[model samples]
Target: MTINNVSLSHHGGEEASGLLEELCDAYADAYGVEPGEEKTVAFRRRAEKQFSRPGFALVTARDGGRLVGFTFGYTLPAGDTHWWGGVQPEPTADFLQETGSRTWVLSEIEVRRAWQGRGTGRALHDAVLGARGEERATLATGPDAAAQPVYESWGWRRVGRIPGDEGDYYSAYDLFVLELPVSW
Candidate 1:
């Protein structure tokens, strides 16, 4: 079950703008990211870009008004060559193609430390994922992230490793993909 008083809800782009700070703040809490850290800043920037994309959406878990968790992503446009942020060994040309509605990228899913193991993250995940209308979905996860096991159990498969950017804050991550309408 989820933590007491937590409500899961949806937010579109307009509403999402007002929630960026709160969303990033909750992200910092969940990821142990220091204030003003490069990753934190980069996350905000990427989030802003995500907001501008068509079909951007956010799902949040709030404990009676306090942000406890969030997950967001958007459907990729017809051409998003940079979206992968660069994958190692590269993928086949066909695999790199996008039809604007073929893929949904789950950018980030975070649950604050205090809310861990109470089902908040899973509920948020299921809610947002259940809302997607794409043929497939993808996300990046660190080898040691707490959510990795859950993703694996839910049928997400490794695609390839996305190398970290120049900044050290962004470590290399394993890119994962799942076919749409996951049962779990």
Candidate 2:
């Protein structure tokens, strides 16, 4: 199924709730585990709060009225943004403190399982790159062979790795970076 008819739009707080759930569920499912009720509720709450912020933006894809995916990110204090923002169990102060300059951190990218290879992810990623020109782009994903190819294909270079606490949350993740030339 080619995603030739998909539409992309920036999502607001109220408009983002329902669709954000699908994205979060995609995250959990992609991790190969079922999310607990608490986890699901917390994910929505956090996403709502972030989406409420001024600098944060979400790009969503819809096909015939059903949402297939979305990507969201925010401008951090350069020294205060992590690849996943605050999604991980670890506090982001350390991650934020290590930074270069003028860049927006990609908080999340989610595409429905069925729509995985249809360019939904790239469409959303392009939105971010277009919105924030120049400044390096960054994100983290599983280190398994499956995710590496996608990151490389997207032009994201492996920069560093984020260590996580035990509990089966981030056992195979690695951080990747993309140096986007600032087009004046």
**Candidate that would win on TM-score:** 1
Task: List the candidate 2 regions with Cα displacement exceeding 4 Å.
Answer: 1-3, 12-19, 25-42, 52-54, 78-101, 166-168, 181-184
Model 1: per-residue lDDT, tens digit, 66-175? 99999999888897656676787688887888999989999888899899888887788889889998988999877567777788887888888877767645478888
Q: Positional deviation of 98 in candidate 1, in angstroms?
A: 0.6
lDDT (tens digit, per residue) of candidate 2 on 1-184: 2346888887655676667657677655544446566555555666777776545677887788777777886655544443444343454454445444455667677777777878788887786567765367666666674767877877877755666545534565676667676242
Cα-based TM-score, every candidate: 0.87, 0.70
| lDDT of all predictions | 0.83, 0.65
| Clashes per candidate (backbone, < 3 Å) | 0, 3
Model 1 clash pairs are none
- Candidate 1 residue 162 C-alpha distance from true site, Å: 2.4
